[model samples]
Target: SIDRKVGSQLMPDTSPGVSRSSQLDSETHPHVDDTPSSNEHHRPTPLPAQLQGRATNKTFQSMTYVPGLTPKIAGILQSKVPEGTVITSTMSRSPPPPNERSSVVYRLGCKGCEAKYIGATVQKTEKRFSKHRSDVRNGILATALSRHTLSSTGNHEFDFEDFDIIGTEKVRKKLMLLEAALIKQERNRINIQEEFAAIDNCYNNLLLNLNNH
Candidate 1:
């Protein structure tokens, strides 16, 4: 028994056992973790050098369109305005079909003459202007303005700068009343000679009735 004990201490155990050095190595140098660190994930992306000081928040503003100066104006605006500011054009363009939910009252005037035309539209004022132009071009003579343009001016030409939007209203009756009020206020300026009295009388009666109600 004494000899067996001495031999057992001298010979290392080899029955499916790991070496001491390998076990110590595994504890010291563990497998690398493939997951990324939290700091790396939270890092922000860098902006371009030119855009470093510019703001990212946006603001929009309306501007009138000038035929030849619009492009130059836009370029100047882009350079002067902050990086995120947006500019919008207020000039009327071809709008879609009529929408009765919103109504607009507007006026159109001759650039050199005092002749003005008061009008209302259920759709956008742009669409209404397009219709007026179409009627004038076709010689429809449907409105007093069309008649005046055909009789006075040999050609159908008007100044775009003279166009103005008076007001907007959702209610049809209120819109009509507003239109009548504008027409009455600008009565002397309009060019409808024979039809003026009739239109004025009609609007006056409507106003009187509405007031009574």
Candidate 2:
């Protein structure tokens, strides 16, 4: 009882789960369909090379034709952004040399006259100008600018350069109150009238208008 047709559909030759030598091997296999015939298509998916390959019937609704999905999203944003990474906004910095500063408030003229000397130091104004040239080389007037540089006689002097910060304060009582407001805004100051008479001229006109700017 074996026969096969399939044109009007009816191929049995051995039903109950076929096996009569595999239904006589279906006369050497013929009717094989897993659903596709109706003109069987599906071979279109090409247009890609940066869309410069022009051919737009607009299909997949636009992912620029998906392959490598936008270069795998730009290679995952260039491996999470970091190639010579530089983004500054307003980069500029430079100012730190005056003898490595430090809570100072200095000034010390007198290369022979107009004698000024306001001072202060938490150290490192070149180590407080080397302790005022070691208290005028060991005559130790112990300050008041070493007793006006060892007793002011016309044309006084004092050396060892680099002085004149005039202000800075990491607070040592606001750096000697900015060295008593710059020795109460000097005027040929040699700093020692009880150190500008212990400050109190009702802010001597705001310290002489901050020493005229």
User: Each prediction's Cα lDDT score?
Assistant: 0.62, 0.63
- Which digits, one per residue and each the tens of the lDDT, describe model 2 over residues 33-107? 446776657666766787666544532221211122234444555578545232212215764776777777777
Best by TM-score: 1
Number of clashing pairs per prediction, in order: 0, 0
Best candidate, lDDT-wise?
Answer: 2
Off by over 4 Å in 2: 1-109, 124-126, 130-171, 189-202, 206-213
Q: TM-score of model 1 relative to the true fold?
A: 0.42
What lDDT score goes with residue 5 in model 2?
Answer: 44
Superposed on all Cα atoms, model 1 deviates from the true structure by an RMSD in Å of 13.6
